[model samples]
Target: MPPSDAPAPTIRPAAPADLPVLGRLGALLVRVHHDFDPLRFIPATPETERLYAGFLGTQLQEPNVVMLVAERDGEVLGYTYAGVEGNDYMALRGPAGVLYDIVVDPAHRAQGTGRMLLEATLAELAARGAPRVVLSTAERNENAQRLFARAGFRRTMIEMTREVEGDAG
Candidate 1:
């Protein structure tokens, strides 16, 4: 949590000017996940920041997508990215809002920033007519799991992964 003396951050829609910081945060996310399981998560490369920013920039004007940032005194402390998705026959699920990413700068973590971003994102998705919202956390991300559970999300699925061996031709 931030010092009580600190002012609260404001949650608002992300802007073009925020892209550089957003890209840095996105690269942090990649590195953290890669640390958790190098084989499962993609490694952060020199171009990751630019690439991530470019990808998210494309979603800025998407009708069903929402990208938000948490700012305090003109500094962006965190951000979340989400979108409404249609039914997935493979998963046997109906339409829903899928949270793609939620990240807070390491210096700002444990300070209510993540929770604020999540609540704001959920509200945005609900306003967009999503009947339900869903997200997948890294198997090792206990902190996020706790936050999601606290926000009334109940577990519905568990994913399992296995690497393939040499070809059987």
Candidate 2:
């Protein structure tokens, strides 16, 4: 078992070998989101691991994407993903960065892993020339919101959804 006072994880760019653990963490992320709001997040399935592996592989090759992993004693503690993009027709702002996902293993929670990952990701996005960064967390995910706020993120928009009582179409 890892010691309670394990040293801080080393943050670095993810490699192909890290995909398996990342995929498992991705599945956990899916479960957390699905539990928090099933209507918004799809539940994880057996195929999710494979799909996430392929997706991460593609993201790794994208010039504007950043993927990082936090490892301690050769074990992955967490991972984060982000990307920079120019504002399209929908977005009024100029170039911006989007924090696509951040997931820390349950056992590593409260150990500063998530904060490290977030800071690293933000730095990478800034290095990529993004003027600002943005992300969305589930309404019930107060922990994540707090983390982002501590990292200097603020509420820029509110996403509200209402399910139609009956089919209008």
Candidate 3:
């Protein structure tokens, strides 16, 4: 957490002006996940920042989506992106709110910024009448796993991946 003298970060709906920092944070998320497992996650490329920002920019117009940012004195410290999704036959899941991304700048981690963003995201989802919310975390992200658990999420699935071409026998 920040020093008692420091102002607490405020959570608010993300705006077009926040795109630059949002893109940077989004790319950081991609890099961190790729670092956890190169084979399981997509690598971050030179265009990741711009591409991510542009993609999220489209979501800004989606009525069922929520994109939020945590800021302190004009500097964005983190963001969360989520959307309410319909039932999916492929995953055998019912309608739910899916958390797509939540990232905090490295310098601001472990300081309750992530928690604040998460809480705000949950509130937004609840306000939208989400029956339930689901999210996936990199298997190696123990910190995030702990956060989710503390927020009352329980395990429901484990995804497995295989490399078909390289495993011919």
C-alpha TM-score for every candidate: 0.96, 0.93, 0.95
> How close to the true structure is residue 21 of candidate 1, measured as C-alpha lDDT?
95
lDDT of 2 at 104: 94
Q: Which ten residues in a row have the lowest lDDT in candidate 1?
A: 160-169
Which pairs clash in model 1? 1-110, 1-111
Worst ten-residue run, lDDT, model 3?
160-169
What are the per-residue Cα lDDT tens digits for candidate 2 across 33-123?
8999887789999988878877898888789999999999899999999999898557567789989899999988888899999999999
For all candidates, what are the clash counts?
A: 2, 0, 0
Residue 113 CA displacement from its true place in model 2, Å: 0.7
Question: Which residue segments of model 1 deviate by more than 4 Å?
Answer: 167-169
Candidate 3 ranges with C-alpha deviation above 4 Å = 166-169
Candidate 2: where is the Cα deviation over 4 Å? 1-5, 167-169
Clashes of 2: 0
Taking the tens digit of each residue's C-alpha lDDT, what string does model 1 give over 39-139?
78999999999999999999999999999999998999999999999998888899999999999998898889999999999999999999999899999
Candidate with maximal lDDT? 1
Ranking of all candidate structures by their lDDT, best first: 1, 3, 2
Best candidate per TM-score, number? 1
